[model samples]
Target: MEQWKKNLAVLWVGQFLVMAGMTMIIPFLSLYLQTDLGLSDPHETATWAGIIFAGNFVTSFLFQPLWGKLSDRYGRKMMLLRSGFGMAIVMVLMGFAQNPWHLLLLRMVNGTISGFNPASVSLISATTPKERMGFAMGTLQSGGIAGTILGPFIGGLLADAIGFRPIFYVTGLLLFLASLLAMFVVKESFDRTKAAAKPNVSIIQGFASLSRIPQLKSLFAVTFLIQFAMIGPMPLMPLYVQELHGTAVNLAFWSGLVGSAAGLSNMVSSPLLGRLSDRIGQERILLVSLIGSALLFIPQAMAGSVWQLLVLRFLQGVFLGGLIPSVNALIRKHTPDGMESRSFSFNSSTLSLGNMIGPIVGGVISGWIGIEGVFITSAVLFVLNALWVNRTLLAHRKQRQG
Candidate 1:
């Protein structure tokens, strides 16, 4: 097999393990605060949980560009290992935390060091053939989605069987193992001498250089909106399920199904849409997907039954799967040579920013106008995103052709 193919294969597993380890704590984070850390007040436990959870994204959002610049200077594989191993140590330390502050601090540190996903993306984008970029990004996305879908479920189960602290240890072990696998198996053709030969630029200059390109700027916006729309409604989903189900029995089970439905379909469809985009155009797929997802959200807002919402979310995921891979492919196509990692890193920063803000905005919107309004609002955002794509990407293609 080709070296790029081997890199993709190993990195896919690495992405899966890394994502799974990161998300494994979510199912019982508040429980850990209450039981182990001795937070007596329910409100305090909830607040600490939110803070600790968002702590990672806060630092990650701020520092991703720095890592991106360094990756361009050094090598993407080195950045990947740095993140993988750094996060491994952080995860293990969380298991030994005696207070919520310790966990919060560790999570922030983990975020500061976190770059595994973006590093893997940079490496893959650097190595994969232009024609295969869509397929590679899509396949890689499916792996992460698969991990996200399963992580909470597995975490919840393990939390019951082996208890919470041990789950952290297990998560740390998984990350370590993934790093080991990458260190041994994944091969990058990055040229350190050539990379170092290029003049070093500040992170601000790198961002400015990339943002000057209209296409890349638009792709970054698309990345932000894609994540914003997807993650915004997630925290409210269980309440929405309860509303639709109109009962308490099996509520957890039904809620879990609703949560995983879109991810499951997304995992199935990303590669398919990616290959299709390769034949047609990434921009076209992206625009159509934005529109399709927007329309689906309108009905989801009005869904009267949990079953209806589940089905709509599943259908929506089919479209959502196309968004990121297409964005990544287009980013690679448009980014200037020698700036690929920084470009991808800036995009990752937007992603982290979206993840950090989406839930907060969603919660606020839900409070003001109910959960349904949040859905309608997200739909509107997607529509705006589609228009942005049309103006920036598709219109340019026509202009060049003409």
Candidate 2:
């Protein structure tokens, strides 16, 4: 196989396994806290669950850019092994947690160590020719989507048959195997002489790179808005459905269906949309996606039945799925070759910040306004973002040409 192909395959497989491991834990984490830990109040359970879950990404949010810069300096391969293998060990340790606090600590540890995906992206991006970057990223992202699609179903079955603890063990083993594959199959192409001769970098200096590019600035702002919109509905969607349906019967099944709906849609449309972006430019596709996302949520807010919500969510998933890969592709275009990982790291960190704040904001709005309010708020954000992108980024490009 060509070296680039080999690198992509290894990264894809590693990403799949790591994401699979993460999925097993995330969807079931609240249940583990509620059932086994004997959490009585639903609100309290939700709070603790949110803390543990969000905390992981919070730590990762702070560290991702740092890791990215390090990958640029040291080697992307080393960062991948460290993040993949380190997270695997943390997942295993989490299985032994006796309380929510313990779980929270383990998650924080895992996040602090997390940098594998960014590392993989940097390595793969380095190996891939510029013309093939979009397809390469789309294909790699598909692996993550595949893991997400299968994870909840498998986790649900495993938790039912054995327990959440056993699921963790299984996840840990797979992650470990992924790390090994990455270690063996993946190779680094960092030009140390080039990096070393470049200007010395600090932690803040890495973040400072964001301000240097207007396109990246626009991309980051738009991404933050879109992600914020997406986060609001996620945490409260199941509860909203159950309340709307007036029963807990098949709640798990329905919730799983809803949760995976986007992944299913994403799987079908991501590559198609990404390819379109490659041809027409990511900015054009981004505008279309934003508009599509905004329009989709209108139906979701107006959904009369659980089935309607699922259908809207599926469509929303298809449109929303294209946004991330397209955004990554755009960022890749703006960033220099050696700094690919660091750029993505900043992007990932910003995304984590969005995820961290999104749920809290969503939950509060849902409580203060209504469940449908969450959808409305999300929709409004998207529409505004679409306008912003058109008026600013697109207009700037035309102006430059003129």
Candidate 3:
């Protein structure tokens, strides 16, 4: 197999472990807070859990660009190892946390060091043959989504089997194993001498430079909105399930199924759609995906049963699979040489921003317009993003052709 293919295969495992480790602890966080941290008040436990959970994204959102710029200057593999090792230590310490504050601080620090995904992306984007970039991105995405889809289920079972504190230790060990795998297996041909010789651009300047590209600016919005629309409705899913199910016996199971249904299809479709994009054009795949996802969201709002919602979400995932891989491929196509990592990093920042803000905005919107309305709102956002893609990407292509 080619070196790029080898890197993708190794990093695919690394990405899966990293994402799984990160998410595996989530299912039992509240339980840990209550039992271990002794936060008996339901309100306090809930609030602490929310803050502790958001803490990672908060720091991750602020620091990703800095890491990106550093990766460009140094090397993506170094950054990848840095994040993996750093997060491993943090996850271990969380198992030893004596209070909510300890966990929160460590979670924030974990976020501060988190760059495994973007670093892997930068490395893969840098090494993969340009013609095959879409398929690579899609395949890589499937790894993360697969991890995400399975992490909670596995975590829930393990939390019951081994208890909460030990789970963190297991998560840490998994991360360490992932780092060790990458250190020995993944190969990068990054030329640090050439990277260092390039004019040093500050993170702010780098952001400004990337932002100047018309297509990139639009793509950034697409990245943000894709995450925003998908994640915004997530928190309300259980409540919506209850509304639809009306005293069903396995409400939690149905809710979990609903939540994960999209991811199941997303993991399966990303590589397929990515290959399709490479043939038809990334812009075309992106536009059709945005529109398809938007139209599907409208039906989800009207879903009469949990099963209905589950099917719609699974179909929507097919379209969701196309969005990010195409976006990443386009970002790679448009980003100037030497700034690839920084550009991908900045895009990662927008992704983290969307993750951070989506839930809050979704909750606020749900309060105003109800759960179904949140789906409509997400639909509208996707529709607007499709228009943005049409104006910026598709139209640009036509202009160049004409």
Candidate 4:
């Protein structure tokens, strides 16, 4: 295989490991907080879980651009190593946490060093051919989605077998192994001398330069909105499952199945949509996905059974599979040469921003109007994003035709 192809394969595994480690806690976070950490009050436990979960994203959003600037100055591979190793250590430390506050602090620190996803995206963007950007991004996304789909299932088994704390140790070890793979296998052609020769721009300057590009600016906005809408229902999903399935013997298992359903279809569909985008255009795939996903969310909000919700979520994943790959490919297409890494970094920050804010908003919406309201809110946001993309991007089609 060619070098870019080789990078994609190795980085695909790297993405899987990183994402799995990150997502493995999703299924049993409350269990860990309540059972392992000795929290008695249900409301306090829920609040703590939300805090611990959101803390990582809060720091990650603030720090990603800084890392991106550093990657532009150093190299993408080194940044990957930095994140991989740092996250590995943090994951291990979480297993040893004596209390909720300890775990919360460690999570905050983990966010400070989180950039593996963006670093990998930068490496792939730099190396892959422009014509195959969509396919490359989609395939890369599939690895993470696969991990996300499997993490909770595996985590549940492990939690039952070895217990909750051990899960963190295993996850951390896998991340370390992933880092080792990246350190030895992945190669990049960064030249520090040339990077130094270029006038060094401050991190803010770097962000400013990219923001000034109209297409990049618009793409960034759409990326944020997309994440906001998609993730808005996540924090409340287990409760929604409970509301649908009711308190039962297998409540946890059913919730895990519901959570993994969307990821399964997303993993199956991402690469296919990406290839189609490569042939036709990313804009077209993105438009259809935005509209389709918007419509799909409505049925999910109105789903009468857990099975119905599962099926709706799976289809929702099928439509949204094209979303991120298209966004990344569009960024790669619009970014100035030599600045791809920074552009991806900014894009990653928006993603982190969505991750941070989406759950909070979802939590508030779920509290105010109930869990179903969160899905309705997500549907509305998706429709608005579709309109935004149509207004901003499709207008270019007319200009090109004229």
Candidate 5:
């Protein structure tokens, strides 16, 4: 009925499509490198797979803030179209790579052009009422989570049915269709006169200005930590699954289920927690989620069975799903008006940073302390983040009261 609601619906589909297209390659990536790219060595294939996979996040991290700042000057819907179409082209091109190097280069470029998620968040935050920010962000998160949960499962089926290269073609086609639809459907209202009146600040200056705010600065740290801790253990999940499932033939199926467990629960709970955060306060939600997530990780590290690990991970998602929506809401609450896009872009950059570094850190930690240690490491990070967030919120309360 409302314009904001319309934007949310359109962007929700767009996010789902974009995330699905991006993640669909995950299940078969190493296999593709080995089978399609003609890599003979298992070690080389694994190395190349890790490189190509991390490549996107590396470039995306560097560019997201730039895109976000530009969106503030221009508009979020425009940025969305740019990212959507650009990614569509890249996704299709990925299917055409003749070697690991070519595919790696193409993946890097995909990262450089990636801004759809940040742009969508900025668009929704700008359009939705502040009171509904949590619910809107939460619902928006569920779309991507659902896509993430289902993408690999669907990709695995398609890979078997049609093959890997064709799967990329299908994913690219779906993403392209989404972008074309958004060209007509997605809408945003901006105060151009105000935008024109606003001084033209360089990206660095714009970033500096936003990060100068104390609350925003703290929030940014929380974002980085959340992502770092949450994703750091991801690269180890398959090996961990193998360790638990030992000598099982259906390792792929179990690994896929384990990988999707958190996302499935997150998709189911993000909106509910988000709505609750809207009423109860996002800060409280963030605090409880951090602690609950930390505690959940402990059981995961100790789980003796694959099913036990899956159950713990699912429960972890129930609370951890609240963290991002609340963090995004707090960023909106603390950031100055008219700069929401840049702030969110910065948030996206931190997320990308976590994605990029988390795996590397997990690998190194796993080497030294082993897989279970990675969970302990993640739990420690979560606890530290919770403490920082709790202390920051307390100071804000005191500052307001005083």
Candidate 6:
């Protein structure tokens, strides 16, 4: 294998392991809070569980740009080492938690310290040739998606067999292993002296880097809108499945299947889409994906059977797969070569902001309007995003051309 491919494979393994560890909790965390943490009512459980989950992402939103800038200044490998070590420490700490508060606090801490994905993206972008950027990012993201596919299954099994705490321990150990390998073996190619002498820019200065590029502004807008649209369907899927009369025994199986279905589509389609973006242009694929995705949710909104939902979700994933890689491609195309990571970090943070709101909005809409209402809301958001991309993005492209 080529050296970059080999390095990418190694990076993917670490990412998969860490993601697998994290995935185990996604399906079960709400249950854990209610049962293990002794919350008395479903409402209380929902509130606290929602808080815990959303809180973790809050820190992720705050620290992403900072980590991106750090990667730009120091070295990608160093940033990876920091993220791995910090995440391991936090995961281990989470394993020892005695109460919900403890777990929530640990999750927040982990989120703040966890810059693994951003760091990894930066490292890969820094090393990969620009022409191959989308393919590389797609392959790397697929690894994480693969991990996500396995995470719920493995986590569900581990939670059932060994207990949640042990799951944390195992995941922490995996993260630690990933950290060790990253520190010892991963080589840095970017010259820090060159990156550093450029400037000791502040956080605002870092953001200004992105705004300086006109195309980046439109790209960021598309990113935020896509994430916002996509997030609504996720938190409510399991609940929607439950309402369809899915039993506990099969609940994990189907819910996971639904979750994994999109991921599976993403895994299969991401690379292909990324490669296609390289040929046809990132903007075209992104537009197609956004418009297709918005339409997909309409069927989901009207899905009467769990099986129907699964098929729609899987197809949705096929289009959704194009989104990140294409956006990343756009960034790579527009950004100064060495500053790809910093630009992507700003993008990562923007998506994190969308993630932080997606669930809360989904949950509130489900509670007040109806579960199906969430889909309508999602569809509306997605459709709006599609329009925004067409008007703002294509307009910007035409203006630049003239």
TM-score, one value per model: 0.98, 0.93, 0.99, 0.94, 0.96, 0.91
Worst 10 residues of 2 by lDDT: 203-212
Better model by lDDT, 1 or 2? 1
* lDDT agreement with native, every candidate: 0.93, 0.82, 0.93, 0.88, 0.88, 0.81
Q: Alpha carbon lDDT of residue 186, candidate 3?
A: 89
Clashing pairs in 4: none
RMSD of 5: 1.5
Off by over 4 Å in 6: 30-43, 243-252, 367-369, 392-402
How many pairs of residues collide in each model? 0, 0, 0, 0, 0, 1
The superposed Cα distance between candidate 2 and the true structure at residue 70, in angstroms, equals: 0.4
- Summarize candidate 1's per-residue lDDT along 1-402 as a digit string, tens digits: 998898999988988888888788889999999999989899999999999999999999999999999999999999999999889888999999999999999999999999998899889998888888899999999999999999998999999999999998988988899899999988788889999999999999888989999999999998998899889999999999999998869999999999999999999999999999889989999999999999999999999999999999999999999999999999999999989889999999999999999999999999999999999999999999999999999999889889
Clashes of 6: 1
Could you tell which candidate, 1 or 5, scores higher by lDDT? 1
Clashing pairs in 5: none
Model 1 TM-score relative to the real fold: 0.98
Instruction: Give me the runs in candidate 2 sitting further than 4 Å from their true place.
Output: 34-46, 399-402
Taking all chains together, the TM-score of candidate 4 against the true structure is 0.94
Clashing residue pairs found in predicted model 6: 24-155
Write the residue-wise lDDT of candidate 3 on 299-379 in tens digits: 999999888999999999999999999999999999999888899889999999999999999999999989999999999
* Residue 392, candidate 2: C-alpha displacement in angstroms: 4.0
Comparing 5 with 6 on lDDT, the higher-scoring candidate is 5
Tens digits of lDDT, candidate 2, 1-402: 988999889888887887777666666778999877778788999889868877888899988988888888878888899898898899888888888989989999898999877787777777887777767777788888888778767887898899878888888888998889878887776778888888867768766766577888777787788778888788788887887666758987787788788888887787788767767777787888999999998888787888888898898888887788778887887786667778888888877888888888998998899988998899999999888878867787678779
lDDT of 4 at 110: 93
